[model samples]
Target: MGSMDRGLRALVGIGLIAWGVTAQNWWGAIGIIPLFTAAIGWCPAYLPFGLSSCKTPK
Candidate 1:
């Protein structure tokens, strides 16, 4: 994924985890999805649509 996409995902994941921790809820587990994807720079959800956030090489 592109830098912007990765950064946004990481931010969102961190936010969710923080919210979950503060609230002491299991929902915080959901944050792993975005966090993992961001770390790997890949999102499985984007596969079927053939979408990509990374810029193409010139």
Candidate 2:
């Protein structure tokens, strides 16, 4: 993933986790999906659709 995508995911994941913690809901754990993908620089959901947020290097 591109830097922008990673940053966005990080922001969203953190928000979800924080919301979950304060709200005492386990659903916040779902944020792990985006966090994981950002950390690994890859998203499984993108694979099936052949979608990539990263720009190709010239």
Tell me the spans in candidate 2 whose CA falls farther than 4 Å from its real position: none
- Please estimate how well model 1 matches the true structure, expressed as its whole-model Cα lDDT: 0.95
Score each candidate by Cα lDDT: 0.95, 0.89
Tens digits of per-residue lDDT, candidate 1, 1-58, equal 8999999999999999999999999999799889999999999999999999999999
Query: Which parts of model 1 are misplaced by more than 4 Å?
Result: none
TM-score of each: 0.94, 0.90
Estimate, for each residue in 17-44, the C-alpha lDDT of model 2 and write its tens digit: 8899999999999988888878888888
Q: What TM-score does candidate 1 get on C-alpha atoms?
A: 0.94
